[model samples]
Target: MRVVILCGGESSERDVSLASGRSVAGALLDRGHEVVLVDPAAAVPVLAGPLRPGDAIDGFAVGKEPPSPAARQQLRRRMHAALTGGPVLELLREAELVFLALHGGWGEDGHVQALLEMAGVRFTGAGSAACAAAWHKGRAQAVLGATGVPVAERVLWGPTANGVPEAVRRLLTAGPVVVKPVADGSSVSVHYVDSLPQLTQLAAEMRSGEVELMVEPFLSGREFTVAVVGDQVLPVVEIELTTSVFDYTSKYQPGAVSEVCPAPVPDAFAARLQELALRAHHALGFGGDAYSRTDFRCDASGEPRCIEVNALPGLTATSLLPRAATGADWSYPELIQRLMDLSTR
Candidate 1:
């Protein structure tokens, strides 16, 4: 099979996407598939041949300042030319499938999937509507709650004046709260506010964006995540971060957080967690052939309350999906193959 692994999008998750792409490419190659690793931002001139291991290309650098408008336009033209204007299009046209290893923004939020769908290309992961719903924390929570899934009590802080203070009051009424942007992942902008003063300070500091903030009661318990692929739930993973909370650093930094696979919870509790995760996934309109991850926090009483559902979960080497898949005895290649197969069906 020929596979095009799309990675390194113009998102905060670009670095993580590159790491995931490297792993996905390696796994696909190991399975005897021809792979083309494309970083859309770094579209370069015609290559002598397909990129080989350690091959370098110019016009792009990850985690750096993005190119100016004109530079970006040129890069886009080159990428479109390379992928759709010449032999590169022919090459991609021959691909058996496109494995989207990109995260955040247009990649994970359904924009790219819509483009590929219009091109009649079969790709992996959820559709645009599901992606959009799940990516927005407040919206997804409402959908999940309607399906009887237990989500944390939350109030959304929209762009209107008085929204922030109202949300803060509601959350503080319940106790310490976690405030985060409504449409963010990787725990970015997530903060724990223990009092009204802290909440007000954080809210004031976060007032510059159109992105709404979400204020929810902090769940005091063990943090766990469940990965679902085509209705099958992988083992639950418990996250134990060295920091007080699992922020962005804890997520991407190796060893910053410890993941206990097949979490030490009882079988019944684990089963319940998987059930809730699947419910949340389906409630968000994720049908068969899509993969999703649902995060939860189990109180001391063993009741697991849903946090959020990642429609497009992180696929980097250290990501939870792969770790859960590994616990299920599925190698990286097998997992990737399975995901592709599921998506194309």
Candidate 2:
């Protein structure tokens, strides 16, 4: 199979996407598939052919903070230049399937998927509609809640929506809360705010920006994630963070957190997690055969609560999906092969 692994967009998760692209491309190559690694934002191929064992590869590193507004503006300018200058569309059309190693921004938000759909190109993971539905945290939660899945109570605010003051008022009356960007992954811009002052400050910062943000009452419990692939639910993954929030560092940097696959929980509890994960996946209109990861958090009562569903989950070595796959007795290469086969089929 000829696989073109797309990665490194102008999204905040560009670094993580690059890492995922490298890992997926290498695994597909090992499985005897023809793989081309491309960074669509830059409109350049990182690799023209399959990788050989012991071959050194250029690696992308993740920073602790997301790119600033100015930097992101610059990235958009470069992206526009590349899209106009490079043959990205032609290359994508030629591939048997595109493994979407890209995350966040246009990649995960349904824009890229729409283009691929228009071109009649096969791609891994969910389709455009599903991606769009799941990319917005509030909308995803609403869909899941409507389908009988338990999701945390959240307050959404943004430029178009003037709910920030209400959110802050609620925080003042309640207590500490969890704040995060509405459409980001890898826990970028996720934070735990403790007091009214913090909430007010954060809200002010967001009001001055163009990003939509969501806040939910902090649930004091363990965090877990479940991966769904081809109608089957993989093992649950538990995240243990050393800090208050699972920020960029805790997510990508080594030793910043500890992850356990097939999370240490009772069979019934794990089964429930898997069930809800599948439900969330379907509720968001994701294909039953597509691959996605649904995050969850157990409240003080130990009941699982849905967070958000990721359509194009990261495929890096330490990514939760791969960890869950490993727990299900699938190697990295085998997992990559299975996802590719699903897309082609």
Candidate 3:
């Protein structure tokens, strides 16, 4: 099958995206498929590498810069041009399927899915609405909470709202709260506050924008991630961060953390976590043939609380999803092929 793996974006996860693209492309090539790796942030360029029976083509570089008004506009222009231009659109027309590996912002938040839908292109992962719902932590939490899924008690704080005082009250009641940006990913602007005084100071230091914030009681338990492919759950991977919490730096940097695949949890608890992960995925309208990584916090009672779901998780060699897949006896190349086949189906 001729596949196009879209990766790299203007989000803070650009580096992560590139790593994912490389791994995916290599895997596809190893599986005897024609592959094109494109960076949606840059202009589509001709991809060339040694051609073999299972060799993949890494093409296209989409330009991306730091998150800024000007940078966003530039990225939009580039995407519009790429999708409407000769090489990218032509490739889409010829390719059998698209393997979307892009992370954060427009990539993971449904913008790219909408574009692919408009172009009548079949791509991997959840559709636009699901992507949008999952990308916004507050909205996803609302949906999960309504369904009786255990989530951290959270209050949304806006820039111009008097919610701060009420939020402080909640923090006082639920000490050790985590403050996170509602729309951001990769833990950008996520901070742990041990007290109301620290929360107040942190809120004051936060940039005044229309961006919403979420204050939730910090769960004191182990952090585990469940990777789901189709209806099958790979394995639970425990994330051990060197820092106080798993922030952006700890996420991408190698050796900053260690992931124990299968999570060293009991079989019953692991099964429960997998069940909840599938529930969270389907509840968010991600029932299609795609992959997602659901995070959880297991308390002393051995119950897991859903944290957040990554619709498009990192595919780096050491990424949680791939790590779990590897533990399931699926090599990197085999995993990529499985993803491609699933997308096409």
TM-score of each candidate? 0.86, 0.93, 0.89
Q: What do the candidate models score in CA lDDT, each in turn?
A: 0.76, 0.82, 0.77
Residues 53-127, model 1: lDDT tens digits: 454433222332323335645555554555444655555566788788878766777777776776677778888
On the 0 to 100 scale, the lDDT of residue 150 in model 3 is 86
Among all candidates shown, the one with the greatest TM-score: 2
Which candidate should be chosen as best, given lDDT against the real structure? Answer: 2
Worst 10 residues of 1 by lDDT: 57-66
- A best-first ranking of the candidates according to their lDDT comes to 2, 3, 1
- What tens-digit string does per-residue lDDT give for candidate 2 at 213-299? 888887788999999998989998999866766678888887788999878899998999999998888888878558899988878
Q: Candidate 3: which pairs clash?
A: 41-62, 41-63, 42-61, 42-62, 42-63
Worst 10 residues of 2 by lDDT: 47-56
Candidate 3 clash figure, as a count: 5
Q: Cα lDDT for residue 2, model 2?
A: 78
